[model samples]
Target: MQGRTLNFVTKSMVKTKRIPKQARAKARIAAILSATDALLRSSLPSNITTTAIAHTAKIPVGSVYQYFRDKNDILEQLYAEASKQVEELVLAEQSAVDPALGFDHINRTLLQCFWQTARSHPTFGALTRWANREHSFVEVTPGTDSSLARLIMRTFEITGINLPAARKEAVLRISVTVVSAVVDIAFEEDDADKAQTLIDELALLLSGYLA
Candidate 1:
């Protein structure tokens, strides 16, 4: 998980002019991010501009530039923050799962966690979609510690499943890829019920495979 998280952060880091040290400066940065998130909910990513973000945030354009390089820089920061939330949510769910209940229960819990995170943050789906389209943000390579794969491996550890290391790595990589693809499509669905159905089906598929 650390490797994959670092990959995103390293790629998306903003080349800011200065880091905020004072409370007021930090608050201004938060306001800028909040305004960008709000704008993303209603408008197309391409249409959003730094001046518009400043206008919405009620801060001067220079202030936006002070902490961020441009609109894309702000969007990258938003993506980085959203990704951190997702990683934390998955890790929390992994810790809460009990191997005694079996892999099916564990699998569903993690899936539900992802769904809840996406639903709670309206900006998440939009930011994810925009990032994928414009920046290839969700591309994870094999051998990297993806959150989904790490969650599965942690389950294995707790359950005493002695799978071979090489095979375990392969299985985890494929599982992460499949789940990531399904999740992307699921979030893209406009209808809430339909989106949930996709997630449920994914849970069943993973459970069967793991079992």
Candidate 2:
């Protein structure tokens, strides 16, 4: 009876402390990532650990484990969030409609959106810097599509490009890939003109594919 009572009390406490949903988990994760961003500017990703993140967030290291599997999992969640943020910006700002064809219109818009998003979320650079050189959070999901992929599909459809499902699928991943690469460059470029130049060049190349 005593052992059973102890187990019940422990389990109840654990349940009470559990994060409610993935959203709550993500919120805590975001707080941790923001702390990491600050720390990484002065240190490297490897130097930043669960203890560092929790200290930065002023939360207990033990509690952090409740949400993230580890530091890499935290980094991966940050990557996914960063990608989603950019994707949301593109989707929200889409205003062009072209059925006659050509990716030019969409490319310019996408570049502009990408620039704004990267600027708004400066930590994105640090996240990408860590994600690419070290641990990437990419996972293969069958029949699963990204928001950026859906945006690309919408653009292609608007342009009257009758792309097959496979190609349409490929285009989304391509757009995310290209936009992300530009982000890598944009973050390092201090000059606005230089950043705009890169955007224009990328937009032109993407447009040519449709034209």
Candidate with best lDDT:
1
- Residue pairs in steric clash, candidate 1? 1-145
TM-score leader: 1
lDDT of 1 by residue, 137-195 (tens): 34422133545566667877876766787787777776777777777777678899999
Candidate 2 segments exceeding 4 Å error: 1-34, 37-47, 95-102, 135-144, 164-192
What lDDT would candidate 2 get against the real structure?
0.59
Q: What's the residue-level lDDT of 198 in candidate 2?
A: 85
- Model 2's TM-score against the true structure: 0.65
Q: Name the weakest run of 10 consecutive residues (lDDT summed) in model 2.
A: 1-10
lDDT tens per residue, model 2, 1-211: 0010100111111122245477767677567768876776677666788888999988789868786667876665555566556656666666544445356766677668767776667456566555545522232211114444456667767767676776765665565566546656665687878978888887886777656
> Model 1 segments beyond 4 Å from truth?
1-17, 22-24, 137-143
